[model samples]
Structure formats: structure tokens, C-alpha cells
Target: MASDIIIVGQGICGSLLSWSLLQKGISVKVYDIDADHSATAAASGIINPITGKRFVKSWMVDELFPAADKTYSEISQAIGVHFYEKLPIYKLLESVKEQNDLSARATETGYEQYFTNTDVQYLDKGKVKNEFGSFVINGGGKMDTQLFINSYRTFLKNKGILIEEPFTYEQALVSKSKVIFCNGYKAAQTGFFRDLTWQIVKGEYLLVRIKDFYADRIISGDTTISPTSEKDIYYAGATYQWHYETEAPTEQYKNEIIESLNKMLHVPFEVVYHGAGIRPSAKYRRPFIGFHPEYKHVGIFNGMGTKGISLSPYFAEHFAEHIVNGKELLPEVDVKNILIKS
Candidate 1:
């Protein structure tokens, strides 16, 4: 069946795009090959306003945060799932230089609104050798991606808009008006995007049942500890590697996370679940969203990286506006401008 849009890979990007387009009365058919390690499935969905060693605000946080909050809230109400939670991120500062750098950046960048200077007391301070740190970031939260995906999947199934199998490349038919590639990483093998630099990083996370370290906030260092309602279970992880034998959790990664967590808190926990997925990260780190250089009808809205939860909503809305209203694309993020040069 010919639809207004045929989306490949029902990960966070595809799912959110379908939701956005459908809200505008556009018809979208989604083809998905389920993978346990798909980024959406493995992501902790933390949307931080400030990131990196420099502690600068993320790209377009002021604009993206409001849109993301509204979008997720609307989806939660529509799907009857509690998927958004605003949480305090406790960033560990291990040195005086790091603290000074963060302080200077906050003042120079006018990002002081997002952060404050605070001291954190670690339960297991002896586990690792460190000193004082600060927690100044504001407007950060977590999205329950698993719950959101399950609810949306059910919604799609009920509407008869979801295909559960891998999309066959042989079945794709391109023309002057449109081209459909409905497969996930499988699309990488297709001739259309082979020349594009696509870097896939495999990551792994562990679901642990630790009872002693009970907090409503998220803790980040070498690894992050995200709180869950169960009181005993927390989502901790993940390790990133560009070269790996496969997209599976390794014992080495599992041990690394456990060791990291042990340093954060004084508690014993059992590993309940382990998951891994590959992120479609680009060298430029901006999302790719435009038609192929030669094929105008062939467009893409991928490359969300680790920030998919926060980036996808705004970009999806932007893409929808471009498709439905003939709006001028923003040059800073326009895929055409990035891929094609004058």
C-alpha cells in the first residue's frame, strides 16, 4: 500500500516521526525488524541540558526541552503510560581544575541558570579516590523508552500500520517521486547510503537490584545509575565501543559497570538483566534529515545518537513542517547543507 510516508526501523526516531506525521492527518506505514539492542530499547533516555567535560548546555536545549516535555506529555496521556520524569543529575567532580572549568563555562556561556554549586556525599567514598564535585545542571529528565515503545507499538498494531518483519531490500522500488528503504541498519548495506559515513557504536547496560542506595535522582560518573520505582532495581551502565565482536553484552562491560557502581554506593546488587544496542552516530553528531543528493523524493530522519529522546521530537516536528507546509529548513541542521556544499 502506498502511504504518505514509509518509515524504516521503528526505533525512537521512526516511532516519533510516525506519531508527528500522523497527528497532522498524514498516513504513515512503519516497517520494523525487532532487535533487542536497538538504541531505543537499550537507552536510559536521560535528557540532560548540560553535557561533556566542558559542562556546556546541549544544542538547542532551551527550544528542545519545552517541545520534548510537551510531546512526551501528550503521548503519555494518549497512550496511558507514565514515561517522563524530571530528575536531578548529580555530576561527580574529581578535581579542582574540573570544577574551575565548569564554573568558568557557566559564566562565559550564560548557562549559569542550568547549574549550581553543590557538594555530594558518596556512600562508598573509599571505593574510589576523589574529592569534591558540583551539580548545577537544570532542565534534565528521563524518558521511559521501553514503556513508550510498547504502548506505541500496541497503538500501531491496533491501527494496522505496523509491519513486524525485516523489510526486504529487493522489495524497495525507487522512482522520481519517492524511494522507500524500510530497514534499520540493514539500510547501511543498500547502495543508496553506502558512501555516507555512518558510525555504529555498540553499548551495553545492566538492570540491577540494589537495595541500599535509594535515591530519586540519577548519579553519573564513569557510569550512570538511574532510579526506578521498584526501590530495589536501578538501571546502570553503559559501556561504549566502536569495535566489537558482536552486539551483545560482554562480561568485561558487565564487570566494569558493577565496579563503577560499587564506587558510587555501598551496596550489593544482583544483575537482573543485560541489554546491548548499536547507536547510529555520525561523525558530525547532528541528526541527518534530508533527501538524497540525487534522489529528491528519498529523504532520511536518522542519526539521533544517544540524545534521541530529546532530539527526535523537535527534528520530527521540523521535518513534518518541511513536508506539510513548505517551510524553509534551518541551515545549521539541514542535512542538505551538511551533505552538499556550494
Candidate 2:
């Protein structure tokens, strides 16, 4: 069947891209192997507004956050599934400096909505490591990333627009459809987007069984512990390994995560599941979006890195507009930046 577009890799990026295209009344034939170790599958899908060592705001959070909320809400309603979670991100104060940084931001006018300096106790029971206290990020949320993508996949299948297989560039045009690579870190192996400086790394997390633990909001310490789609099973993780030999789970990092969790959490917990997946993080920490220089019909939409959950929906819509209307992508993320150096 000749379709308007053929998207590769049905991760968050691909799924959002397909949805955006489909919403615009475009036909999209998706290709995905549905790997068990995909990043989207392993992700807790927490959409944090502020992050990093200094606890600064995430890139484009002001704009992207609201768009994501709207997109997820509309999609959830359309599919008859509840995947988006609107909750606070309680950042545990680890040190005096970290405490001061947050304090300074709370007084600032622009940061008022996202940061609250009011003395609040989210997890201060000595069981979850918050001796210094924590602040609330008002508009933080999470999405059941895997659940949303999987459900959307079934929706596409019913529409006769899905191919449950890996796509290779060799099969393009022979099928007469524009192919956009929405595959995550796997795109690093393909030569088409080799100009992109990928800082790919495998991230590890755990699905743990903890009794009577309240998961009203996400908790952060050395690692982030967010609620999973399932009740009572929180997603605890993630550790980054630059020199990992396999994307498969490792016992060393699993124990490492447990150690970190123990510091934040004094409770004894059992590891119900361990998951590891590679992120397509960019060297400059920007997404690689837009078309190939030589292959006009081939485009790359990867390199979302750690912020894929928050960033993908906004960019997916932008990318769709670009494809459908020949609109301009911001110079920073434009694929022409890669071609300029090439």
C-alpha cells in the first residue's frame, strides 16, 4: 500500500511523529521491530521541568511542557487510555549549595510557578532520604511512555498502516514512501546520520517492590524514583555507563542503584525487574532533525537524548509541519547544521 510516509523505529519519537502526521490526515506506515530493550520501554516517562547538578530549568521547558500536556491529554482521550501523569517533582536537597541554588530561584519572578520554597515534606520520614527538606515543582508530570506507544501501535495496526519489522534504507522508494528515522540510539549505527556526534550511553533502572510507599510525586536524589504505570511498583534508576558492552541489564549497576536508593530510601525492597536501554544523546545535547543532504526523501529525527519524553511531542509536530508545508526548523536543531560541516 502506498502511504504518505513510512516512519522507522516506533519509539516515543516515531510514535509521536506518526500521530502528528495522522492527525494532519496523512497516511503513515510505521516500521519497528519493537525491541525489548528500547529506551522508551525502560523509561519511567517522568517529565521533569528542572534538572541537572545545578538544578536549572530544562531546555525549552516553558514552551514544551504545556504543549506536551495538551498533546498527551488529547491523545489519551482519543485512544481511551490514561497515560499522562500530572504531579510534582520533589527535588531532595542534597547539600547547602543545592539548597541555596533552589532558594535563589524560588524568589525570582519567572521561576515562581515551577519552584516553591515553602517548607514542604514530601518524603521526610527518614525512610526516603530527605533530611535537608525538598521543594516542589508545581507543573511537573510523567507519561506512561511505553503504554501510550504500544496502544498507539495497535491503533495503527487496525488502520492497516503498520509494519512490524525493522526498516532498512535499502527498501525505500521500492516501497514509494518517504522514510524518516525515528529510531533512538540505534540510528548511530546507520551511516546516513554519521555526521551527528552521538554521546550514546546505556542507562539502567529498576522496577522495585516497596510496601506502603507513597508515590504521589516523583522523588529525586542520586537517582530518580518515579511511579511506574503499575501501582506499588516504582521505577528506580538510572545510572549512566559510557563504556558498556551490552544494552542488557547488568548486576553491577543494579547493585549500584540499590546502594543509591538505600541512601535515599531506608526501606528494604525487592527488585522485581531490571531494565537497560541506550539513549541517542547528542554531543551538543541537541536533537538531530531534518533531511539528508543527498537523499531528499530521507530525514533523520533522532538525538533527543535524556529529554526525549518532554521534547519529542513538540518537535514531532514541528517536524511534521516542516514535512507537510516546507516550513523552517530552528537553526540549532536543523539537519543542515550537520550538512554545513560535512
Clashing pairs in 1: 37-277, 114-138, 115-136, 116-136
The digit string of per-residue lDDT tens for model 1 on 1-342 reads: 355577777888888888888999988788786834468878888989888877777888889988898889898888888888988787777777877776677566457656654334443453333366445456788887777777788888888989887654344444322434423445455645544566777788999987666456777777888876566788997777888997778988888888887776655678999888777776677777766677566667777777889998998888888877888777756667766752
TM-score of every model versus the real structure: 0.89, 0.95
- Candidate 2 colliding pairs: 173-176
Question: Which candidate gets the maximum TM-score versus the true structure?
Answer: 2
Error of 1 at 56 (Å): 0.7
Question: For each candidate, C-alpha RMSD in Å?
Answer: 2.9, 1.7
lDDT of 2 by residue, 75-124 (tens): 88888889888988888887677677788877777777786655544574
Q: Give the residue spans of candidate 2 off by over 4 A.
A: 1-3, 120-122, 173-175
Reference-based TM-score, model 1: 0.89
- Give each model's whole-structure lDDT: 0.73, 0.83
